[model samples]
Target: MTTLLPPASTTPAPGGGACAAAATPAAAATRRPVVGSVHSWDLSTGVDGPGTRFVTFLSGCPLTCLYCHNPDTWRMRDGKRTTAADVVAEAGKYTRFIAAAGGGATVSGGEPLLQPVFTGELLHRFKHELGLHTALDTSGFLGVRATDALLRDTDLVLLDIKSWDRATYRKVTGRPLDPTLDFARRLADLDKEVHVRFVLVPGLTDAPDNIAGVAAFAATLGNVSRVDVLPFHKLGEAKWQALGRTFALHDTPCPTPEQVTSAKGVFETHGLYAV
Candidate 1:
């Protein structure tokens, strides 16, 4: 629940060169772009799909969601240095198993868009080289300029909509909601497949009206594949303490199953499929 804003100045890699030459045929097949930082990878968390899917937890995020589960990933300099080729080589080992189980690599983080060049390269290699499914878990706060070519190779977009109301969104994420909504609309317009996710945080984002509003907005989009209502939990409380950060939702309890069900119902009522 710690709410630490990202530093004002983030140093992106110069000229945005390729991290390294794709050594293998799989790597050579994809055009990998150069990026600033090669943070760490998360071999844990099997949430991407079936099989043993590898996850790359990139550094940096723009949003300050009060109930973020991975506070440790907020900083832009916390993990080890690695390049796109490094990640691809590591993930390539389990490509066969992942593909057989309908699973592949998932790029998650404080916000993958913060390192768009690196993310795009990873997706390119996953598709053109390894021929594996690629998914991006983002907050949708990134602007149109940052998402242009990146969306072309992404198979699935896990778009997290913090709140429906503009004012409420600012309160929850410490950023304007318009950019996020615009990004979602652009994804829908481009016919990109997306899964709209909303975190149901009690006393903050679980309001009935807000849920209904988000559903209504999603109904206007043509490429919405599903809506996922994630119940709030204190999974990252300890991380906040370890980081010496103050938790914002210290007294907030986890949402009940009924609450999650009700929120899902709202999306269903709006003609958008909810999961």
Candidate 2:
């Protein structure tokens, strides 16, 4: 979730002339415009979306979450500059398989909304052209960037709400909490389908009040169809080490299954289906 932009490097032409510049910009404009900075792509099941999925992990994020597993995705320049057409072409390969299994495409991130135009175009292609269900996995930090056109094509949104309290949210992710809240409200107003994901860390986000607060807020939003109370783990510790960053929860224990169940109970108490 850390938003870090590494300096970009430009490769000069061998002849070192204006002709090189012309070839680059003109060709780029003619193509999909290189809007989606891609980190990676993969196939997932029973997780990102309804059934199976082709997940696109884009680059760049606004919030620096302490538990971010893919710290390498923080820098936009580090990702491959890809176009929507190429993305759809790749997804099209498994279109029949995904459709048969009641699955579709999911654009996850660093923050897919960081490149709204690219994400929008990709989703549009999947929904309109390929006849596929489209989902966006986001932190809701850049929710304002989700234009109506984009939302129109997205069938589901996997919004990761880090924390409920503003102070605690800021502490967990080096960003304000309001933007995510505002985005959630927007999704509700649009009546968009949403699956809320909340991680339960033993010492950080496991406070009873914090869990209750998130549950209360989610209950207010009628669009929320499900709550995923995930247990914290050290899965991302290696990534942090590789990045030469401090892994804050190194010694913190993960939430016990009982604790996870209790957190889910809070959401159920609010009459929302939670797991």
Best by lDDT: 2
Off by over 4 Å in 1: 1-39, 43-52, 145-147
Tell me the tens digit of each residue's lDDT in model 2 across 155-222.
99999988887888999999998889999999999999999999898888988999899999999999
Best by TM-score: 2
Clashing pairs in 2: 1-63, 1-64, 2-64
lDDT of 1 by residue, 129-173 (tens): 798878888888885545455677788888888899888899988
lDDT of 2 at 48: 91
- Candidate 1's C-alpha lDDT? 0.75
What TM-score, over all chains together, does every model reach? Answer: 0.85, 0.88
